[model samples]
Structure formats: structure tokens, C-alpha cells
Target: MRFATWAGGAGVVSDAGLHPLPSGVSVLDLVCSGLPAALEAGSSALAGPPVPLASVRLLAPLTPPTVRDYVAFEEHVEGVRKSIDGVGGVPPEWYRAPTFYFTNPYAVVGPFDDVPVPPGSERFDFELEVALVVGRDGTSLAPGDVDIFGYTIMNDWSARDLQAREMKVGLGPAKGKDSATTLGPWLVTADELEPYRDADGFLALDLRVSVNDTLVGQDLLSNMGWPFEELVAYASRGTWVRAGDVLGSGTCGNGGCLAELWGRGHDVPPLVPGDVVEMTVEGIGTIRNRVVSGVDLPPVQAARPRPRIRRRDV
Candidate 1:
């Protein structure tokens, strides 16, 4: 079942239309309850009258408890590294394991929401990717043990100029990335994607993105260095990956983002106000968002140098 959260409330999507779940039960609640329970809830809720899908305003499927985005695509990593470092190659550490960084959960936006150009940013960009929602709490899980609730389209919006400057300090994509993240249209249950899994067990869904009606990039979901299960397993290494948490499959190869294309010598213009970004993952669905101007920010003052501390014996 495709689950969604909209102006009306949480509901199940069907050919008939959107069937509202009982009042007070949210998509988050369903995610935390795991697949069996969500299936039961969706089945029971279908008896209610359905609402036209187009009439309702869709929202981000759920407010994730935490969002961990990985760099699982070698092509994207190599291309981005070449652009930033003037060399094309993947780091050795990257091959050892799936690496990820935590992005702000609160920065999430709905499928069709307006994303503002982050304050002090000029090189705004969109990343085409796929994300999975965790269905149960788990830690140190093996790949086969990962419990995923569903999948959705994710746009990891970026401010390239800001990200470039911050990472120089050796520590962030922080403010550059925290500006916004788009997830939704609706979340398709994991079972719905089984038919699309390849012989190696990787999802073979087709991913495409367009900027203002111009096709910018396309890739296969199976291009990742590791599968979603492995990404989740790495994420659960020592910390708990609770239900409602989201794990992104990073950017796809070939042209997942402007940066990747730019690294490959493609001269694409950065995103600007009024530019609409539409991304689609074959089985899951599509999400469209428009860029808008952000609130002007006051200039930040440079930090003062701290006095050197004398070493003392413990």
C-alpha cells in the first residue's frame, strides 16, 4: 500500500482514491508500528469513503525522527570529488563501508512545497535520490535483519557555495544542507518494490529529475555501491535506528545533482527562484517543488581565537 499524509490526515492511496486512516493515527504512528500493523490499519481504513487524490494538498509523508543520508554512489562521489579537489577518484575509506551524515530532520518539506534559496547562498542545487523509512527499532543489525517500512523520493537540496566553504573547516555540510530536504508524494510499502528487485537483490527502479520541464538527469537505483539494507546496517552499527527514521541512498550516478554534472564539465545554471524541480522514482512516485527566495540573513561575525591552554597532568 502507498501511505500518505495530506491536509486531511494520514491515509492509504488506492485507485479508488485516498482513504483516510482513523483520526489521530498518523503516518509516523504507522511507521513505528511496523509493516504487519500498517497493513492491518490500511486494510481496515479502506472501508471509509475515498477522497480524490488531486483535491488534497500532500505533505511530507512523515516528520522523521532523524535523517541519515549516505554517499553510496561511486560515480557521484568521484564526480563531486573531481570538481572539488580537481581529481577524480573515490576515497579508500568510502569503499570500506557506507558512509553517511546526519541532516536536520526539521528541515524536511513536502513533495510540492516551496524550497527557499538558503540565506547567503547563490549556488543552490537539487540532488536526485531515494530514501527508505525504518519500521522498527534496531541496533547493530545485519543486512538481512533490517526492517524497512517503505520508500519515497528524496531531494537533498543543497547550497553548493556554502557547503564548499564550510567543509574547508573540515566539518560540515551543516548550514548548507540544513536549509531543506524534500520527501514524499507518499511512501510505498517495501513489499510493493519486491517485483523491481534485481537478481543481486538491489532495487532496479528508474530515477529521473527535471528542472523547469527540462530533463536534467537519470539513473538506475541499483547503481549504488551498497544496497539499502547495508546502508541501514551501517547506520545501526552502535546507535539505534528507530522507526520513523529515514535513510537516504545518497545521490544517483551520471547526473544526480548539478555538482556531479559540473564535476563532469557540464555547465548547468544553479537553481533560482521560480524554477520547479520534479523527481520521479518509477515504482514509488513523483515529487515536485518550486524554488523561492529566502529571508535575508544578517552577516555573521568572525569567531574570536581562544587563548592557548597550558597542558596539565591529569
Candidate 2:
């Protein structure tokens, strides 16, 4: 079943419209409680009168506990390596395992919310990705042990100029990425995606992105180098992955972001205020956001060098 959260409350999406869940039950609560319980709750809620989808203001499906985004597409890595690092090939270390980085959970916004150009940023961009919400807590998990509650479309909004500078410091995509990340429209349960699973067990869903109503890029979810299960497993290694934690399938290949196109010598313009960016994952749903101007502030003070501690001989 597909579920959504709106200003009123959480609801199950259907042909009739949205079937509101119990007053206090939220999408995050259902996700933490597990699928069987959510199914039971949804079953009971279906008896109530449905609300029209267009009438309510939709919000982000849930506020994730944490967000881990992985680069699961080699094509995306290859495409952006040059532009981001001024290098032309995928790094050898990337093949050893599915790698990811932590992004700010607090920065998440709804499918149709307005995303501001991060303060001090100019080259704003959007990344088309698929993200899965964890159903339960687990540590040191294997691929088969991953538990997923559902899937949603993710737009890992980027501030390319800021990201490039941060990467040079060998530490972050921090402030550059912490500005905003988009998830929602709604979340679709794993069972609903069964029909789209390929022979190799990967979801073969089509993904597309558009800027201001013009199609910019499209690719297949099947193009991912590592499946969601594996990415989850890697994320679980030596750490706990709990319910409501979101893990993204990274950027899709072919033309997931403007950086990738720029690396290939394409002259796509950076996102500007008033530009509407939309991303769609076939089985899931579409998430559209409008870019808006951010609050301008003066540059932060630079870090000062600290005196090194003298080591005493043992």
C-alpha cells in the first residue's frame, strides 16, 4: 500500500483518494511498528470515507531518523568524477564496497516544497535518486537481512560550487549538501514493487527528471551497481540501521544531475530561483520542488591554526 502524510494526518493512498489513518498514528509510527501492523491499521482505516488528493497539503512522508546516501551507480560516478574532482575515471576503491555518507535528516523537505538556493551557493542542482526507509533496527546485517519498509523518490539537491570547495578540504559535502534533500509524494510498500523486480532481483523501474517542465534526463533503476539490499547491508556494517532511517540509491546514471552533464561537456545551466525540478521513479511517485532565493550572509570566519601539543617520550 502507498501511504502519505499531510497537514491533517497520515493516510493510505488509493483510487478513491486518501484514507486517513487513526488520529494519532503517523507514517513513521507505522513504519517503526512493521508492515503487518501497518497493513492491519490501513485495513481498518479503509472503511472511513476517503479524502480527495488535491484538497490537502502533503508533507514529507516522514521525518527520517537519519539519512545515508550511497553512490550505487557506476555510470553516475564515472560521469561526475571529472567535473567534481577534475579526474576522468572511477576510483578503484569504489569497487571494493558500496559506499555512502551521512546527510542531515533535519534538512529534508516535502515533495512539493520550495527549496532555497543554499546561502552562498550559485551552482544549485538536483540529483534524481530512489531511497528506502528501514523497517527495523539491525547491526552488522548481511544483504539478505536487510528490512525495508518502503520506497520513495529522493532529490538530493546539490550546491555544486560549495560541494567542490568542501571536497577540497577532504572532509565534507556538509554545508553544501545540508541545505536540503527532498523525499516523498508518498511511500510505496515493498510488496507493491514486486511486479517490477527484475530476474536478478533488482527493481527495474524507470526514473526521469525534469527542469521547469522540460525533460532533462532519464535512466533505469536497474542500472545501479549495487542493489538496495546490499547498500543497506553496507550501511549496517559496524553500525545500527534503525526504523525510519533513509538510505538513498544515489544518483541515477545517464544524466542524474547537471554536474554529470557538465563533466561530459554539456552546457546545462545551474538551477536558479523559480526553477521547478521534478523527479519520478516509476513504481513509486513523483516529487517536485521549486527553487527559491536563500538568505544571504557574509562569509564565515576562517579557521585559525592551533599550536601542536608536544609529545613526551614514554
Residue 53, candidate 2: alpha-carbon lDDT: 92
Tell me how far the alpha carbon of residue 104 in candidate 1 is from the true structure, in angstroms, after superposition: 0.5
TM-score of each: 0.96, 0.96
Stretches > 4 Å off in candidate 2:
305-314
Clashing pairs in 1: none
What global local distance difference test value does model 1 have?
0.93
For residues 250-306, could you state the per-residue lDDT of candidate 2 as single tens digits? Answer: 999888999999998899999999999988889898888999999999997888898
Query: lDDT for each of the candidates?
Result: 0.93, 0.92
Model 1: per-residue Cα lDDT over 1-314, one tens digit each: 99999986989999999999999999999998879999999999898999998898999999899999999999999888776557788889999999899999999999999999999999999999999999889999999999999999999999998898888899978988999999998999999999999999899999999999999999999999999999899999998999999999999987889999888899899999999999999999999999999999897788989968789769
lDDT of 1 at 65: 93
How many clashes in each structure?
0, 0
